[model samples]
Target: MNMNEKRFEEAKSKIVGIQRNREGIGTLQEKTVHAVLKNYYAPDVATHEVSLHNYVADIYTGNEIIEIQNGNFYKIRTKLEVFLEEHPVTVVYPIPHTKWLIWIDETTGELSKKRKSPVTGSAYLAFKELYRIKPYLKNTNLKFCFPLMDVEEYRLLNGWSRDKKKGSCRYDRIPVALFDEVVIERREDYLQFLPYELPEEFTSADLAKSAKIPSQTANLVLNILHFMEVVERIGKSSRSYLYRIAKDLG
Candidate 1:
C-alpha cells in the first residue's frame, strides 16, 4: 500500500485498540472521524490529549500542537489564543471530498438507501470557518491542515422539511479513506488556492467559475485572502468588486 493508505490503516487500528482497552475514555468517546484524525496526525499515545496551560490539546508533539476540530472555529478561539502564545499550532480540519448519505428513521430504526451527495467538497470550504478566526490568521505560529476524505454520513430523518433532509442532524461521519491533504503554513501557501486561469482582476463570479465552487464560497475565500493581503480590492466592476492578487504576492 501507499504511504498515506498505510498511515490511514494504522491510525484506524490505533483508535480501535484504544476503544477496546480504554473503554472509550476522554477523546476516545468522540466520533470515528475525530478519533481517526487524532491518531492519524499523532499515533503516539503519549502525545494524544496532552494538557497545556488551561486547555487540553488533541495532540501535542512537544514542538507543535495539532487540534482536530470538526465543528465551528468559534469554539476553539480561546484555546488557540493561549496555545499560540507559546507554541506553534496546526488546526486539522476534515472535509468530505466525497460523501454518501444514509438516513435512519428515528421511530422505526430503519436506514434508508445510501445516496451520494450532489455537492463535492473542497478546501475552499475552510474559508467559512477561517473567517470566524480571521484575527488569528496573521500569527506566524498558526497553521491549517485540511484532510480530504471519502466518507459515509449517517443522519436521522428528523428535519423540518418535507423530505426531512433540510436542517437534519448528522449522526456521524465515518471516514472511508484519505484522499489528500492541504497544509497551509505560510502566506505563500495560499497561492495554491487561486486558479491559474484567473485574470489579473476578477469578480467573485469569475472566481466561482474558475474554481468550480459556489459564488458564496468564492466570496468568503476572497474575504479571508483579502484580510491576509494575498489579494487586494483593485476596483469595482459594476455591482461586484474586482480583486487582484497583491503585487507582493505576484
Candidate 2:
C-alpha cells in the first residue's frame, strides 16, 4: 500500500481503539439519544457499536434501541429488521430534523438543505416487517431481539449547529434512559435551547406560513414563551402580538 493509505489505516485504528477504551462516548447518532435520556429520563443506558454481531446500534436504552438515524432510513430499516429477527430488543430510531418534503425545491437525486424524509409514509411497515420475523421473535429465552426503532432525537437535537447564536447540546446525558419527568424539570431550558431543531425565533411567521398552521399556533407558541417570560407582546399587528424570548438565564 502507498504511504498515505498506510497512514490513514493507522489513524483509523487509533480512533477505533479510543472508542473501545471509552465506550461511553459513541458516535454522533448515539450522542443524540444520549442527550435525550440525559434530558428526560433519569435512568438511561446506551451503547456504541462496540462489537460486531448483525451490527452495532448507536444507543440501546434498556426499554428499546434508540438509534440516531442520519442517512438512508430504508437501509437502516433493513439492517434492524434482520437484527430484530435474531435478538430480543425493542428498537427506536430517531430521524434527523431534515427539511419537510413540502420545502424541497430540488430534483430527486440532488441533495439540498430541503431534503425530504423517506420514512414518513412507512413507519408502520417497519412494525409489520417484524411479524415476518415473528418466528424468530417468539423465542423467549432465545433473547428475541427482533423489531427495531426509528428514533427522531437527532432531529430534535439539530438546534445545536454552531452557526446558531445559542442552543448548544450538552453531552451530560449518555448511556441511559430518562423518564419523562426530567423534561418537566428542565422545560424552560428545553424551550430556550430547543434541543431539537424547530422554527428559529426569527422565522416563526414564515415557518407557520409554510406548515399551513394557523397564525394562532404561532401565537400560542409566543404565548407559551411569554408565560415563561421568554417573550412578550411588543405591539398588536394584523393578526398577533409581538414577543421575544426572555434573556435571563437563571
Candidate 3:
C-alpha cells in the first residue's frame, strides 16, 4: 500500500480501537474527537488525564504535554500557560477539510439524509481561534498542530435551528481520514503559511486581495504576526497599518 493509504488505515484503526474500548460506557467518553486523535498521535506513548503543575492535561508523555483541543483554544489559555513553564506542550486542532453531514431523526433511529457540505475548511480557520492565544504562540515550549482531515458530522433533529437543514445539535464528529499535519514549532515557521505572491511590505488590503481572505481576517492575521515578532508595523496606509517581516526573524 502507498504511504497515504497506510496513514489513512492507521488513523482509522485508532478510532476503531477507541470505539471498541468504550463499548459499555454509560456517560460520554471524553469527546470522540479527542479520543481518536490522542490514539493516532501518541498511540502507546502517552497517559490520559495526567496531572502536572496543578493542572490535569489530556495526554502526557513524561517530557511533553499534548492537549487535543477539538473546540475553542481560549478555554485552555490559562492551563496552557502553566504547562509551558517547564515542559513543551503541543496543542492538536483538527480541521475538517471535507465533511459529510448526516442528519438523523430524533423520534426514530433512522438516517434522514446524508450529503456533502459545500463549504470546505482550511488551515486558515485555525488562525481565528489562534488570535485568542496569541501570547502563547511565541513560547518556545509551545507548538500547534493542525491536522487536515475528512470528517463525518452527525446532527440530530430535536434541536432548534433557523436553517433548513435543522442543524440544531451536533452529535459528534468522526475523523475518517487524515490529509496532512501542519506543525508550528517556532514563530518563523508561521511565515511559511504566507502567500508567495505577497510583497516584501504590504498592507492588510494587499494581503486580503492576494490571499483571497476577508480584510478583517487579514487584520487578525497581522495582529498575531505582530505579537509573535514575525512582522512589525512600519507605517500607515491611510487607515490600515503597513507591515514588513522583522529584519532578524523569518
Candidate 4:
C-alpha cells in the first residue's frame, strides 16, 4: 500500500475499532452509494475524486451531482433542496416506501430486517423540496436512478463474516459481480485490472481517501453491491467486508 493509504487505514482502524456499529453506519451508506454509481455511471464523462473532512465521495466526473439521502432523510432533503435551488443541478431521492426483502440460502428464505424505507415519506418531501429548487429539474437534462435490488438473491449468499452486523457482501464477491452484471458500463475509471473496479482489501478510511466520496456513501454502495453479488462480508471477531471480483463471472 502507498504511504497515504497505509496512514489512512491505520487511523481508520482505530476509529472503527472504537465505535464499531455506531460509527459504521456512515461507512456502510457510502459504500452502497459508490457501488450504485459504479454500476450505473457512463464512461464518456470524466470522473474525479472528492473528499470533505472525514468523508469521501465516489469518483465524480460531472460538475453537477445528485446525492441520494437515506440517513436523516428529511435533513438531507432539506439541504439538497436549498443547494439545488442555488445551483443548476438535479437532486434525486429514493422513495422510502419501496419495500425490499432479503433472501436466505436456507429453504425458509429469511429476509434481512429493514429499518425505514424511503419510497413513501420521502417522495412527497422530495417533491415539495424540488419546488424550492427554482424548478431546476423541469428544464434540465440529467441522469437519476433509484433501481430496485433483488434482495432475495443477496440474502441467500450471506457470508456471515462480512461485517459486525452482517450486511450484504459488497466488500468481497458481490461488488465485482455487480460491476459486470449491473455496473459494467461505467467501470472504466475504477477498473484497476480491466475487470476489477475497487481495491480488494481497503479500510473504510482508505476508501474514503481514494474515492473522494463520503465514508457513509461508500458503506452503502458496498452493501448494495453485496446484495448485487459483487462482494462478500466476512464474519469474524473484527468483522470486516472484503471487496472482490466474483471468480464465477466466467
Candidate 5:
C-alpha cells in the first residue's frame, strides 16, 4: 500500500481503538468519518479538539487548525473567522468519489442489498458549500483540502416517495477507501479546478459541460471564483454571462 493508504488504515484503527476503550467519549460522538479524519490529520490526542480563543477546533497542530466539516459550512463561519485572525486554517471536506447505498427498514431493522450509486462526486461539488462562506475564500491564511473517498451510505427507508427512496434521511457514512485529494492553498491553486478544455471566454453552460457538472453547480463555482478574483465577468452572451480567468492570476 502507498503512504496515503497506510495512513488511512492507521487512522481507522486509531478511531476503532478509541471507540472500543471509551464508548461515550465526547469527541467520539462525531461520526466515524469525522473521527477518522481527526486522527489522520493529527494523531496526537492532545491536539485533537483543542480550545483556541473560546472555539474548539477539530485538530490544532500547534501551528495550524484543521476542521473536518461533513455538513453545512455556514455553521463554522464564526469559528473560522475567529481562527483565521491569528492562525492558518485548513478545512477538510470529504466528497464521496464512489458511493454505495444501503437502505435500512426502520420498521424491521433489515438492511437492503448494497447498490452502487450512479452519481460520482468531484471537487466541483464543494462549490455548493463554499458558496456559503464566500467572504472568507480570499483570506491568505485559509486553505481547503478535498479528500475524495469511497463510502457506504446508510439511510433509513423512510421517505416521501413510493419506494421510500426520495428524501430519505442519512443515517451515517462509512468510509471504505481514500482515493485522492485536492488541496488549495494559494490563489493559483484554484486554477486546478478549471477544466483544461475550457475556452478563453466561456459561459456556465460551457463550464458545466467541460467540468462534467450541472450548470447550477457551475454557476456556484463561478460565483466563488469571481468573488476570489480568479475569474471576472467580461461580458454577456445571449442570456448567459461570459467569464474569463483573471489575467493577473499568474
Candidate 6:
C-alpha cells in the first residue's frame, strides 16, 4: 500500500515535463498517462503500437503483448481472444486508489480549488472493468496487472450547461504515485481479492454485505468469480443465483 517516494517524485517530474511539452493544443491531445506508464514499465521495448494477428497492441515485447486500458475492457475483448491464442497478453489497468480533482475556468483561466475526491479505490475496483471480459479470465495466456495509483485529474469546461464546472471533460489524469500492483495470472490468484470472511453459501447480496461494496459491484465480481471457476452456482435464491466457493479454491 506504500509507494516509493523517490520513484513517485521522479514519475511526477517526468509527467510535468510531458504536460509542458504538450500544452495548449486543447482539442487534440497526446496519450500522456499511457505513454508515461508504458515507458516506466518497459523502456527497452520500443515496438509500440504494434500489429499482431491483425490487431494493434499498445506495446509488444518479442514474446508478449501489453495492452494499456484506462477505460473499458469490452472495447478490446475481440482483440484479446484473437491474440491470446498465439501470444501472451498482459492487460495493464491503472486504478486511482486515491484521486484529486482539478477544475479550470474556461473564460477567466483561473484554477479552482484542488480537492480530493471522496472515492477511494482498491484492487476490487478492477472487477468493474473485468466483468466485461469474464470469459477470457481463465485463459492460460491471459494476465491482468492493476497498478494502484494516486492520480490528479484535470478537467476543462465544455460551456454547454448551467453547471459549467460539472459539465467539463476530463482532459488529463496524471499518475502521481504507484502504490502497488495486483497481478493475476492463475484463477487461484483471484482468491486474495475476495473477502476472507465470505459465508459458506452466499448470494450477491451476501457478498455485497460481506465485502462492504455496492450490490451492483458485488454482482459484477460474482460474475467474474463464477466465470473463473473460483465459485459455482449451487442453486437459486429466488431471483438471485446462490454461490459457494469451489472446493479447490477453499
Residues 81-110, model 2: lDDT tens digits: 655654544333222222132111123322
TM-score of 2: 0.25
- Give the deviation of candidate 4 from the true structure as CA RMSD: 19.9
* lDDT of candidates 1 onward, in order: 0.86, 0.35, 0.77, 0.36, 0.85, 0.78
How many residue pairs clash per model?
A: 0, 30, 0, 68, 0, 0
The TM-score values for the models, in the order shown, are 0.90, 0.25, 0.87, 0.29, 0.91, 0.86
Q: Where is model 5 more than 4 Å wrong at Cα?
A: 1-3, 16-28
Which lDDT tens digits does candidate 3 get at residues 125-157?
A: 788889878778878898888888887777776
lDDT of 6 by residue, 1-250 (tens): 1235565556556645654423532333555578666766555546777888888888888888889999689999999989999899999888888999877676776666779999988778889888888778778999988888887777886646786765578877777777788888888987775787877888999888888888988988888888888999999999999888899878
Largest lDDT belongs to which candidate?
A: 1
What C-alpha RMSD separates each model from the true structure?
Answer: 3.6, 17.8, 3.5, 19.9, 3.4, 3.0
For residues 1-250, could you state the per-residue lDDT of candidate 1 as single tens digits?
0237788878867664545322332233588889898888777889989989989999999989999998699999999889999999999999999999988787976778889999789899889999989999999999999999988788888999999989999877777788889889899989898999999899999999999998999999988888899999988999999999999889
Residue 69 lDDT in candidate 1 = 90
Q: Rank by lDDT, descending?
A: 1, 5, 6, 3, 4, 2
Q: For candidate 3, give the lDDT.
A: 0.77
Q: Could you tell which candidate, 3 or 4, scores higher by TM-score?
A: 3
Per-residue lDDT tens digits for candidate 4, residues 144-194, read 333222221133445566532365442211111111111111222123212
TM-score for candidate 4? 0.29
Indicate whether candidate 1 or candidate 5 has the larger TM-score: 5
User: Once superposed on the true structure, which residue ranges of model 4 sit more than 4 Å away at CA?
Assistant: 1-34, 42-60, 94-100, 103-144, 152-250
Off by over 4 Å in 6: 1-12, 18-28, 159-161, 237-239
